[model samples]
Target chain A: MGIVSPGFSGRRRSGSELPPGQYLTRDFPVLSAGPTPHIRTEHWEFTVTTETGEATKWDWAALLALPADEITKDIHCVTRWSKLETNWKGVSLDTLLADVETSADYALVHSYGGYTTNVPMDDLLDGQAWIAYEYDGEPIDPEHGGPARLLVPHLYFWKSAKWVRGLVLSDNQDLGFWETAGYHEYGDPWKEQRYAGD
Target chain B: MTTDASYLDGNAAAGALSQVFAMDVTAAITQCNGCGQTGVFAESHVYVNAPGLVARCSGCDGVLLRVVTTPSDVYLDLRGLTYLRLPNP
Candidate 1:
């Protein structure tokens, strides 16, 4: 039998504070696939490209000028770590997608390091996500996806692309890097969908 | 937790693989069976979000190694690599 580590209870929480097969973490872990791309604020830009290839662009100042919100929510990682009551500040995806009209059902999120992930259109709208730039009242560190990252608290944290650059709308679902390599297409931590077959 | 697109390079796997191997495997040169490419293990893309650690060839994205840890065993699969040359420490 495996011995439990000290002060680490494997018991599940009563409320939604914790998800299945997940452990609460006080320290935010740094996870990335490649080297951290240091993007200057002046060079920072966000785009939303439609299926037809029409693109909407937003510079750093333009994004910061928009109405922003400070969100406090729980975040779950597919790696089985859950951070509760995390604070973030960012402009809502709703605000960014407000002017753009799209009937596409899937979103292929692109990051600066050439990383990509797919998310549902519904997950990016209706105040469900944000282009977060700050964490805990401080500018997010580069290792943690500073400048901006897509924050989708509902799905696994991986779906929240770090160093996010743009979103490409697609009529069909397109698997991103990890998804192509055997990760679950739709990562739902609640269901423990960590791998392709899961 | 591993994310769908979040991945680290083989450098991240050094710490984990060290537990099983006597030498630092990340510095080892591995030949990709799929692409015939040779490079340091640290250059391979490492995915830790899944049930195990998967290292893929950067040249071809072909899986070079996989390490799965269970309650009583650590399963390692290196069939994707043609050969792994580790330096003597």
Candidate 2:
């Protein structure tokens, strides 16, 4: 409710966006733990591994062979910024998982340069997510997780991991980077779940 | 805001940090406890586009300050700074 940080202030949130306690931002700000890894398209690959260790992988060309859809959706970040109507193009999870079989209930998305985030398997299926390679009509910038990234628009944007490489399906919901760092396990902006206790 | 660097300095967060601090904390001189590198707060690496804002020492990549602001509470930790002397007068 107030600022207690060393010489720090806070931003107020107002407006009926997709989430509570979030402000609207037009500019797409770049966020990263270290640096933006430049993954060459030719060397890029996407994979889906089941709990039993069976995996289906697709390189750049193979991924493009799948049907690509243009998607426009609103994305909310737990950091308190809601960027609405972000346009993306990629293969939907439904298309990607149509042939794959698995009984796992969770998915841990891994990215290049060692970044990871977990999402409920249900949140990823039934056309809920995509392996988005394009943003706003251009190949995603490396700084914004370009080449390819997860596009789980419903949850907090962190679930849409940048520089996404592949996924490892599991029965257990292993906490990812932020989740292990006290961020809410399931970050649903509507519920105002930004922290662990909340 | 280019592909050249994935991160930006402390200036980008001035607006959000302004809500609580009357003065610009980015102008403060902070010495990192890890590497003993001293610089203006504005020169530190600020990862602001996340669930929270984490300012790290550009010298040794040590976390200088961590901030997470929820609807009902504000959490700030400055354990990485040996001393943070703000300018006034």
Candidate 3:
């Protein structure tokens, strides 16, 4: 006699498919802490600033001009919902950071409406992350982080900042908004690292 | 105060808070102690990415409520808010 939500399929995956304390959801729930900031594509810009203050910027057209890749990945949120096989199209972070040379170890991501998050520089390089603008072959809705959002599927969804605008390379680690407020500095969903302690 | 990318407003916490609070907590008006600003809880910033659900003052980014749920107990801290005016049911 387990309580199930209205549309829950009652289907269970093998132990390896889902992480501990997580449930699979067919719907992609929209969760945001504040009002959705509507940014026009014409007014959008993405910047990458180095520790020394050197910054390189890409406008909306410039960003779209870059080579894009189609990615299908599983995303797990700390709130206990895991959505698998999500599709997205975007420019890889590797392509964005390629020309920029830096010895920094951390990346502080900034969003359009003043939101910020920090991630290890290594985690965003290689084929690990991207600045996604399209979902399921359509332009992403503003409510779901439109113009472009950081997509890092390896860690918890929170590590993937929404409405991303810039990335600041830092030599030392600094906690972002949630990190300073007691969320785990590194949100690894597989280990259930939801809070600072565990 | 710096904005958090991993957070949503108080309205987002209504679903989680409903487990403890019977009524709609988002519609409740709250006064912040730090800035003495009054606003609906639905507009306050909420960070659910952590172990607990934290609702912050939209005016000053102060923690207005913190709810932590463990296996045995649910702890709620509302020290940052001077008062919360709940609607009559």
Clashes of each: 6, 2, 5
**Most accurate candidate by DockQ:** 2
Q: How do the residues B6-89 of candidate 3 rate in per-residue lDDT, one tens digit apiece?
A: 678788888778878888889999999989999999998897755468787878776788776655555577778999899787
Which CAPRI category fits model 2? Answer: incorrect
lDDT of 1: 0.83
> What's the CA error at residue A2 for candidate 3, in Å?
46
Q: For residue A193, what is the lDDT in candidate 1?
A: 80
What is the descending DockQ order?
A: 2, 1, 3
Q: A81-174 in candidate 3: lDDT tens per residue?
A: 9987788999999999999989899999999765678899989987889999999899998878997899998888888988999999999988
Give chain A TM for each model in order.
0.91, 0.91, 0.91
For candidate 3, the per-residue lDDT at A89 reads 90
- Tens-digit lDDT track for model 2 on B45-68? 887656667777778767777666
Off by over 4 Å in 3: A1-16, B1-89
List, residue by residue over B1-89, the lDDT tens digit for candidate 1: 11334678789898779878998898899999989999999998897755468788888666788776654556677778999998767
Give per-residue CA lDDT, model 2, range A25-122, as digits (tens): 89887767655678999989899999999999999999889988788777888767888777889989989988888999999999886668999999
lDDT of each: 0.83, 0.81, 0.82
For model 1, the DockQ equals 0.11
On residues A69-166, what C-alpha lDDT tens digit does candidate 1 reach at each position? 77777889877888877889999988899899889999999998677899999888887899999999998888888889999988999899999999
Evaluated on the second chain alone, the candidates' TM-scores are 0.90, 0.83, 0.91
TM-score of each: 0.72, 0.71, 0.73
